[model samples]
Target: MAKIVNREEMAQGTIILNEIIASRISRKAKPGQFVILQADETGERIPLTMADTNPEKGTITIIYMVIGKSTARFKDLKVGDEYFALIGPLGKPTHVENVGKVVCVGGGTGIAVLHPITRALKAAGNEVTTILGSRSYDLLIMEEQMKAASDNFHICTDDGSQGHHGFVTDVLKDVLEKEEIDLVVAIGPIPMMKFCSLITKEKNVKTLVSLNPIMVDGTGMCGCCRVTVGNDTKFACVDGPEFDAHKVDFDELGKRLASYLDDEKQSLEAYEKANKQ
Candidate 1:
């Protein structure tokens, strides 16, 4: 059983850190791999990226948000509680190289996803500049972690609470105007990633974005995680959770992602009502 060893409320706005004892998975997991875990025998399977790992301790840390019923179910589990099933180290790892100056941008939950990747890039001797953002100061996570992962760290908030008072792109644009950035990796809300792609494409800077489409089975057999990159279709669970930002068809991806909004809203509302005494 993959038991929860440590749990921390990373953010009040849905994010959490769940450290689970999965010896094999922890040992084999790479920077960009993810796992599909079920809350219980009857729980739905949900995929979460590995935020950190402790091979010696036989543990893997996953940061997630209580977005729908599957995640909200974690609220009932204690540290010692075990997940019903835990599968993978899925997806290809991030392509990290010492490509001169690297800029890693993350927003909201994406910060957690970007954490290990940034660390890897820094380890490869790239002069990493990390940009983390959130709508407000309170929602910003992994500030210290990001700082440790890059040579230079920046913060952006839609509201001027902790750092620059604007979107992350605002800071990114400023950086691009003066800096000789060699590579860029962006992970965040769809619109944010989309805009980041647009900017980098215009500047002719190579940019990559991590995709998180709806996934059922972690295998590519399901095809639910299909995404269009350039002219080819790729599966996010197997081929990537990352792709070239300039090549991805963001317009199609955005429309498909929004399809679940109504269902997600209803599920959250129903869950809230039931939990209310």
Candidate 2:
């Protein structure tokens, strides 16, 4: 059982951050890896990227938006509560190198996943710039942390509630035009990633995107997370959650992600109704 040592609510309680005691995972987890956790015996297995890991404290922090039934269950667990199961630092770690000027773009909950990677890039002697976005100011998260991790940090809100007052792509395009960036790492909503990749492709800049396809078993055996990259079927669990942005089939991935929305809605509705009863 992984005990929740601390918990905090963010983005008006729609997102939750939990620091769980997982000594083994904390010790080995690297940037870009994820963990599959189950809230209880009857809960659905859900994969969450580690927002941060503290080896000395033997804890792994996960920040997730409470979108469906499984995440709702995760939100209900308090600091003292424990998870029924938590399975490891899965997927390939980010290929960190001092690749000159690098820009990391993140949107919504993807900002959480981008945090560690940005920090690692900066640590590896790369001048890292981070651009984060949300629909509105209130929806943005981890501002101070992301700022600290990046040598240059910018924010964008679709509603112009704060920061650049435009899409992250706007800031990215401006940066790309002004500087000679060696690489770009983008993680966010599929649409945001798709657009970012599109912009980078035009500039001929190397870009990497982290994918969050439907995953069941964190292991590659499930075949549920298979995605087409440059015409090859790749399982995100084993091959990568990160891929060359230009090679990803974003449209196909977007469709695959929505395949179970109706079912997910029904599940969340039933869980909410049952709880209210």
Candidate 3:
């Protein structure tokens, strides 16, 4: 059992947990790795990337948004509670190197996943510029941490309640035009990542994107997170959660993501009804 040593609400419907797991996995966890966790015996396994890690303390931190039944169950667990399963340091780590100027873009909960990578990029001697966005100010998470990791940080919101009153891509385009960017990494909704890739493609900047397609086992054994990158098939669990953004088939990805929507709604409704009784 993995014990949750600490927990905090970072934003509305989002929670961060500090968990003590086996030292082996924690020691091996890199900036872009993820883990599959289950809240209880009856709970379904879910994949969440490591937001941060403390090897000396044997603890890893995960930040997740409550989007569905399994995630909602996770939110109810308090500090000191134990999780049924916590398996990993899974997936390929972000290919980190001194790539000169790097632009890291994240939206909504994707900011949490991008935080560690941004810090790693900066430490690798890259000039990191970050653009973070949300529906509004209250939905934003990890703004300060992202700022500290980046050479410059820009914020955008749909409702004009934050730094820049526009989409994150708007700021990204402006930055790309004004700067000499060598690499761009974006993590967010499918459409947002698609647009960021589109912008970077014109500039010939190498871009990477993290995919959060529906996952189950979080291993190649399960074909659930399969995505098309270039012309070949790749599993987000084993091959990568990050891939060359320009090569990804965003249209197919968007279609596959909708496959479980009806089932997810039914599961959430059943969970709510059971809880109410």
| Best model per lDDT | 2
Q: Using alpha carbons, what is the TM-score of model 3?
A: 0.96
- lDDT by residue (181-240, candidate 3, tens digit) is 999999988899999999999999999998888788887887989999999999999999
lDDT of 2 at 186: 97
User: Candidate 1 — worst ten consecutive residues by lDDT sum?
Assistant: 8-17
Q: What's model 1's TM-score?
A: 0.97
Q: Give the residue spans of candidate 3 off by over 4 A.
A: 14-22
For model 2, the local distance difference test gives 0.94
Query: Who is ahead in lDDT, 1 or 2?
Result: 2
- What's the TM-score of every candidate structure? 0.97, 0.99, 0.96
Could you give candidate 1's per-residue lDDT for residues 27-134 as a string of tens digits?
Answer: 998898889999888888888888899999999998888877778887667799999999999999998889999999999888888999999999999999998889
Q: Provide the overall lDDT of each model, using Cα atoms, as 2-decimal numbers.
A: 0.90, 0.94, 0.89
Candidate 2 residue lDDT tens string, 1-277: 6999999999999999999999999999999999999999999999899999999999999999977899988998998999999999999999999989999999989999999999999999999999999999998999999999998989999899999989999999999999999999999999999999999999999999988888889899989999999979999988999999999999999898888888888888898999999
Q: Which runs of model 1 end up more than 4 angstroms from their true locations?
A: none
